[model samples]
Target: MTDTRTDTRASAREILRTLVGRDDADFHEGQFEAISTLVDDRRRALVVQRTGWGKSAVYFVATLLLRRQGAGPTILVSPLLALMRDQVAAAARAGVRAVSINSSNAHEWAGVLEQLRRDEVDVLLVSPERLNNPSFRDEQLPALISRVGLLVVDEAHCISDWGHDFRPDYRRLRDLIATMPAGVPVLATTATANSRVVTDVAEQLAPAAAASASASAAGQPAGPGVVTIRGPLARASLRLGVLRLPDSRARLAWLLSHIDELPGSGIIYTLTVSAAEDTARLLREAGHAVRAYTGQTDTAEREESEGMLKRNEVKALVATSALGMGFDKPDLGFVLHLGAPSSPVAYYQQVGRAGRATENADVLLLPGIEDEAIWQYFATSSMPSEHKAEAVLGALGDAGGRPLSTPALEARVDLKRSPLELLLKVLDVDGAVRRVTGGWVSTGQPWVYDQVRYERIAAARLAEQQSMIDYERTTGCRMEFLQRALDDDTAVPCGRCDNCTAAWYPSDVAVAAASAAAASLDRVGVELEPRAQWPTGVASLGVDVRGNIPVGERLAAGRALARLTDLGWGGPLRDLFAVQAADAAASAAMTSACVRVLADWNWEERPAAVISMPSRRHPLLVASVARALSEAGRLPWLGSLDLVGGGPDGSSGGNSAYRLAAVWNRFEVGAELAAALAPFAGKPVLLVDDLADSRWTLTVAGRLLRRAGTSAVLPFTLALRS
Candidate 1:
């Protein structure tokens, strides 16, 4: 008995109401407003969004909106070839005619180009390298762009040197974009761009338009059009650790153990091809299904390796920084820095590779004493400041001011080896040069995003570098320093780190001083809490089944240590420190105790001293106690920075268990902690921390005491309270 017309009208109104009520399910009002302005103006715009912001979604929506309005074919310039493939795939999934043209294409590209010319495609993806191609510019681009209504530049930061993966060709994109149809809107997007890059992008793409706009405009050419979509780095779910290692062997061991123990897919990033291969080999030898990828690897190898990891055929991967530039796998669980990268931007990019699928991810940095020297090798060797400008100019001459191969330019320039590359990179940042094929070439003109302003914006970046140096030398409140640096005024000491938990807590003697009238408890207040219970005022949680001694046999050290950590002891004692008794004639009591009692003690240091303690409970106790010590902030000098374990000499060896005490008391270590950790620091001293179960966590704590001029190794006993 209801009217059909009225019922239909009511249903339509209800659908409209549902959309309005679910506005929160979409973006905030402000985001929609900003997007609407960009789409409506039909003018090219730059969108500065932080990582995890729905940057791609914004553009996707914009693309669809523009298409609906009868805009021409949308051209998307992606920095990475892989990213182009990913986008095209996504477009295809969305039922759009999307095709990519890159170096990989031989026959398919011709068809794609034909489709573009015929206006049969809705989107065409190209790499920046292809945009610089003469044939592309002379024959393909003009025709292709003529049909383009919207031009999109993804990861826009690649155009600036301040960006981690700065590409010389990106600077030239502005010039080529200029040749496109007038009034064709260009939308540039990136996850990370400082103020300088923002200004540079504005001037380069929309120069005249930005120039005419009001100077007081927010995120404008006079300023930066950045929409602060988010505020502050999130640290709640993030547990940061730093470990110092002594040698590469220990580092490898540390990596083996940590990678074995870490759950989910992980990436171990190295600086060079050789290191990547070596790391993968070591891990594989340890029975881990690990794959290696680097710039030298053929594209097929890279793809296969990536596929294996994605499909869970391999548990871990060792790769150079270039391995996953455009990769979109979302299930990444952990990121390990086999070596420190050249810049903070590099650090963010590599680490950002993790936790992409709304999953938890952890990052580990393992540095060694030689780390600085290696980085100095990376920074100062061939690219010394004095020779940079000359080499760049020479390369320009070699190219006859035309694009040329990198090898050819190196032959033409007569300077140090690396400075030429650095200079080229620098010029590329300045928009004075572009990298094409094997050579350097002029883009025919300068762009608005100049290097000078970029350098200025990159100033804060040095503070992070300085923090690394300070970590090498500092001895106090390493956790406090790290928290302050990463979170600024809101930083608080993270109890998870060695320095905050172990070094800062008061000694037993100090507590007596504070409570002079109280009688000393006979039990020493040691209470045994099950790992599941997580006792208050105790940072370590380990279960001692069978009373810390299984059948009174000394051989059960490794199993006992694992049990302790599983119970929540949370440290590196699954092996290194354990139960064994030393011979009295061969070693001093402490040394002998470490040998006979411990599982792996070498006696090269003792001068006629002997006697060893039985180690049935030593290793597990040491690890458990160390965990407790670190969490209580009694040994604040150790475990501050985010790193792997330190070696015997207190350098990070790339292993997790090897990260001993974080550098706490000193201002700088005189040498690099590892081949990589040193280069980031301008000086030697810095504060640091450790990741859980990393070798450096155990060794550095002991080693740093020596560095601070203390000769004795501090020991902790774990006897349950009566």
Candidate 2:
């Protein structure tokens, strides 16, 4: 008789070859072992291999093997839409039927569910976020749990809050594992986990088996333990290097000068959306083909761009972290960063995109001086606040069991959108709340704020930030530094890296390149679209507003000299808003830019008057800019709007409801400004402010002015705060 091992190995190799569409395709070194543990031993396994490693192949091959032996279909919990799409295509090549139920394909969810019920699907993919979805959690998930042959969690490092990109949604997997049937093999795979994350995930993976082991004395069946297969994290094909520039300008120049010299079509990563869009535009203007990918990009647009990069149709994709993990492009030529990522682990994960299936790929970092400030700004919103948590809980409890939408809850809390969304996820995972069809409802479960855990995670993040700085400045082996950061003990100098050899990349920024880059960044003015619809739950906050504001009462589409995050005039604009800096008049250059904006505004009619908002933080700056624009356009200067009880703080950057509440009826259309505007009663008047955030301040002010008989309110600002 042919041995089972021989049969299994042969079957797996055949599937691998077919899946890759290569006659000689075979499993990587640890791939077969992971497959065997799953198929032969029926054991739980955690594979923490590097990016290009064949972790997906192991589970796919095993899934087929388990089905042949009469085991039920595999349930795969994936994290991204792109990943699910890729996995389904890969599974089909191996003759494994895969179906997914996610937000994008909601129209086809019924068919997919039907496929699952009929056992037509060999593998079912669902996002971790969907695991707690009320309908799925209440019905489909429980049925799937009873008969699932194998459970797989991709990008499993997210299961640990200690991981670099800890997602609270992934935490729901612990409860998932606990309720899983005994002896049902489980697989969790990731390319980015450090030792700490590995331990936490391993413990989480075996909770069911642990419980079964403890009950063995009472005749309950025992279960096997979790097995981990981790390998070296080094990429021999990657030549890593960091070139520090004096500022943003130099970095853009460096990218412009050397982009063509890079090996092949790849990625250009930026920290912010504006940077991605701006960089992509500059590259295109310089006669290179590129596209920008950010969290803000429409879903269909992102897919189209990803396909372009994969097919080598575009020279590069200027992107943010949205394109990070589970994106597979085996021969991706390079990964160039416009700014250093905040964490070393995240940096490694991004750069791992290159050299996966090639002999070599270039990886370069252009570290900017503004990188740290950007890092701090992004980090501030992630940590949950106890006070905010209590406020949200209190608001939910007072609802008397009715669900309150996120917008409605925002009216009752001081937290901003980003932080409030994060808090809701944390609460949902901790059993403190549940998300029903309408919105969120309290679970009435006891919740303890884990201050120490959050503190520890915060400390780890700081250490990682310092590590990223050290990585940038390190003269030692670059590959070794990254491997060590991921807690791989086998790390050693990769002779291919720049630090090991000489600098393989260009050192000097050509004068022409610098000049071109500067001219490219010399852009000014962005159209700021006016808010047409009022935020919901406004009346609850005593704002006396709901639904769409009448077009006659709305502020005309406005303009800003520049965005605070712009590559051109952003530096000067940022300096003006420094927290501790004394209020000062607008600088000459900024004043000139504002004049240029007015000259090019393309407004249908010139303003008959100028009005400034009451500024609590920068009265002089607002007054100066208003005065400058009025003098430049030769329009009447209608003194600042009056604040009744204490003008809207202008300092609070909360949600729309709160901002509107603070600004509503607070700006009085006093006689002084009204009298100045009376002469221009039938014409447009320019309303100026130092900054525009939430846009409600401008919205409320314009509504009042329109009601007081101004024909049109032309809103303008020094900068748009995104």
Candidate 3:
């Protein structure tokens, strides 16, 4: 018989060599075994290997081998559009035809659909989000599902709620796997999962494992189940280190002072979009070739930025997590985090981007005190609220089969856009709703709250955060610390880590660099544009307001001293607003910054008086700014807005519809304020507040001021929350 297994092995070797374009290319320890598991045994498997271990190579080779046997196209579900693009390009190198359908290429979806119909695509790459998309789900997915040769889930850790980055969309994969055709080999791969995450992913890969396969007395499975192949996760090329800089300025100064000494073009990760943009701008201003790649970057700009970095045209790409996951540049030099990620697993995954194909790569962390607060802001809202979930389901039920779009649902629900979308995904996965062609409709399926699971996930996250803090302070081998965090059994002290070796980096920041960085931080003031139109469906919230604001009811363009997320003044402002920080008079620096912002203001008409907004959290802070500005300009202090019906008690983070509803009719023309504004009837006035977020507060308060007889209300704030 000529040993069919040997012939198949030879064929797989050739495919791998062709895919990488090197005759010398070969599989790592478990790559070929995984391919054979899929190709020969036709069994499901999870590959928990580290980055650069050729996880993608196994799937591409298997897809080609199956195609040679007349199997239908493989379906590869990736989490990011960028990752999909990279995979499609990678597939091309293997001479395998691949097509993708995502938000970025809606115009080409029809062609892709046609290609799929013609059976021209060897692999179809789609985002996990696309699986729940109405058109894809209703019109295209069924046909594709019936014919899919193999199913591949990339970044599989996301399917586990215990993972650091648990996404609701990835939960849909379990349902997909459950309904897959019999005998189809499935593969799930990730590098960041710990023990819990791996176990969770394995269960999802075989959702009915307990019932479908029962071990006999011989300790063998009654049927085939998912097998996990894990390897040691130590990265030999990464020289891991941590620098405990005193403050944000010192970190930036160190970066400016020593960036040239780093090997090649690399990435500097930030915790926020604003931080990325600020860092990139500051670096570029200092004559460094860099670009900001954030979620806010448009598709074309993102492509250009990635290309610039890949071509080594830029020294770095200051980025948030948006640039992460499968962005391959083999010899990329360094990975530096401006602030630590909350989880060590997330940190490991991020730093894994570097030194993949190089002899040495640098990985460093600069921890910040503010990182915890940022982490809280994101983690607090990650799990869906039961109250909000009920509201969404009730709204959908009220529609009675009419597909309600996301915007319409937003109007009917109190949650914000991002959280609303997340809730919807969760509901869809829970069988409470179905995404149809138009939008979402109630499925009339009862959904449990899963309180226990949510609580456990939250607790796990806190522990992960504490582990990251320990990571920054650990004296043990840095690489070994990460390996143990991931539950690797083979962890040992890497000879190259900072703890294992000496401090191989410069620690002292130059005086000139520090001064320049401080000056850059001193740059302040952000222009605030007034909200022009009322939120759609506000009338449903019991407010009759609609359409664009009439000229008379609108506030003029305003200015803030800085954004709350700014690098320069943000720290002081954040401290001022901290929960435990007592309210006090404005600091001299703040008063001076306020005066400078006013000096830079080029409004068509200067304010003749000052009025403060009603403040529950920062009364003294707001009052001090108003009083200082009033004294500076020698203008009348018209007093603050009166609190009506206990004031707007809605929380700080609610969506626009509810925010407006909460404040509507809550403020009235206080007899004293109305009387004081009589003289400045048509003159502009500075309306001071502590912060500008959502802008709904400013809009509602400004409308009241305008209706109560005031000229252009120049809304000024100490910080603009972006």
Candidate 4:
């Protein structure tokens, strides 16, 4: 009664404390005090929080504090649809009313506006791309300005070119924020952002700091200073290994063998969607649970696969670079690359999906010599041509504001065949034409993806690739280089990569380097995982073994091995020995162990299984062995094993042809095809001249061999070299 105002304030504080206590809210000392200061000062704040940091709490607390002071609902803009959904769910759990406004609900504009006007929604999330919508200003925005007390942008770095995945609309968000009611607060957050981006965002949101109370006096610095966090990048528990391959088939086989180690949680990234689908099909045929994700997959399928991945139903996912944005899964143990990614930014984001919970994880990149060519393709191919652009604009035929299909326009245009697609793509960007169905429609204005700007973007990428190549081949601290590039001052040497591992302890590196060099004489050099039919009574021998008994022993191991060696591997057998035995009884109980040792020893993949029979004149022994080898038709090229008995009549009694199953193994195809395939190790070598005019044939064969395991990949040629 003596002080009614003071009593009311005290009662409100008690109610707030009790509500927070219901959720077991532990007061974070100084956390809210700083936020309260930011609110009181009415300043715009951009916070950079590392992964696992409670960044949401910062904005969350700010929202609650400001709303308590009679400010309006908070407007949060986020780029990801999934993250938005999760936030909505979390809001319900926290007893806060939230509304999401996105393209999906464009028809419900009126109802959403009504809710915003009534102050029924405490938080509203929107996509940046929606700003261009006609209704943003006409019907919905008035309520937004009147009710939006706090403005929050999640993943705010998307506004900068340096961001991992840039979305053009993010840049427009800054201007949109500036249009907010005067004195309304703004807050932004990102898991990663460099200093330049931070400064740029600050300028965008509060350009007129002096007019607002949040601004520091004249030349004074702002309060609640930016805090930079530090942490180690290496997870010591993970064992890292790097393996280089000659082509995709060997890579495929290696992945197939180790797939048991990967589960529904692992990811396999390819350079393109076609490759992803091919790899997925191959894995599926081998009876593994797998799926593929690409930019082109229908939205429904993409969502289903994503749900399956989250539920741990799909064992493996093959995808292009588009699948990795903000995808958080702590159990992801492995991130395997079927090939090198298009860029280091793509590479980093894909690999970062693993080891979220600090559990042991692996990131594997199967680099090949041809990788640079693919990188060059993406770097060079996207450029647009002025000629093409002209053709496109000409196609519009005075219809400036009309929408058209890009494909249809391309068909009508007469530009250089190669650059036409890029030109139309550019026009879509320049806003001259918006993408519609398979074509483009005129937008009455210029856009970025148009022909004129295509070259500029392409040239920039080429330069970036050049820089990446230099960094990739450099002999320096990788983390340091990355840190320097990202403009972070605290990047220390991450002693886990090839270069850092070598630099951290030069003595050990030097010793290992020398040992490797010395051991190279005996080592096979070409590293490959053990083939499926490993250690199975097969001796892959070289034809140079002209000695009768040794040759006989090699021959007896399996005709497949003998044939492979005779094919040309025999030419290099002195330097490289190839043998495989998948039969446990034929070798030992430790087939997997032997394969691991061989992998370390640089042994490559070869068909290594064969049926064996002891030397015996007995008909049953000969007949039984012949039947078994004949039935084991899977190792077709790997000749059958027939241990010759001591008698002169052994050859006559044993039926060598049937026993070896040369007919089944195709040994009977004469030494020519066997000889040709022998060098390939079952892989199809691209016959250039053979497919000079019939490249389609070679392409088909390549697809078939890819489905089969570990086939030799041949180079595209003008004519057959063989």
> Could you give candidate 4's per-residue lDDT for residues 1-722 as a string of tens digits?
33643443343344334434453354333334335434655656655544434445555656666677788998888786656765676566545677788855668667877887788777888887565444674457666777678888887766654441245567667567768887777776665544555555555555543233123312133543222222323334332334555545456666666666653367888876656766686678667788988877876687678778777888878988767765656577778886666544455556767776665666666665545656765554444446556657866755455655443443355343335544544454345655543345566564333333444455545655665454556677554554554445566666776665632211111343233322321222121111121111112211121112221111111011111111112122212211231211212212222223323432133334322222232333223333333334233333322222331221211111121221122112224344434444544222111011212222223333343332443322111111
Ten contiguous residues with the weakest lDDT in model 1 = 552-561
Off by over 4 Å in 3: 163-166, 208-223
TM-score of 3: 0.96
How large is the C-alpha RMSD of every model relative to the true structure? 20.0, 3.4, 2.5, 18.0
Q: How close is candidate 4 to the true structure, as a TM-score?
A: 0.55
Q: Model 4's lDDT to the true fold?
A: 0.49
How far in Å is the alpha carbon of 475 misplaced in model 3? 1.0
Name the weakest run of 10 consecutive residues (lDDT summed) in model 2.
Answer: 212-221
**Candidate 4 or 3, higher lDDT:** 3
Q: What global local distance difference test value does model 2 have?
A: 0.87
Candidate 3 per-residue lDDT over residues 1-722, each given as its tens digit:
23766777899999999999999888898887788878887888888899999999999999999999888999999888778888999999999999998889999999999999999999999988899887788788999889889999999988999642356888888988988898899999999988778778878889655343222112233257776778889999999999888888999999999988888999999998888988888889889999999999999999989889999999999999999899989899999999999899999999999999999999989898898998887788677899999999999999999999888998899888988988888888889998887789999988889899889988998999999999999999999999999988789999998899988888999898899899888777799999888888989989999889888999899998888788778889888877799888899889988988898889999899999998888899999999999999899899998989888873677688877888888877699999999998888889999888888788888998998878789999999888
Per-prediction TM-score:
0.56, 0.96, 0.96, 0.55
Candidate 4: deviation at residue 268, Å?
2.1
Instruction: Identify the candidate with maximal lDDT.
Output: 3
Model 4, position 46, has a per-residue lDDT of 59
lDDT of 2 at 430: 89
Which residue runs of candidate 1 sit more than 4 Å off their true CA positions? 1-25, 28-34, 180-182, 208-237, 380-464, 467-722
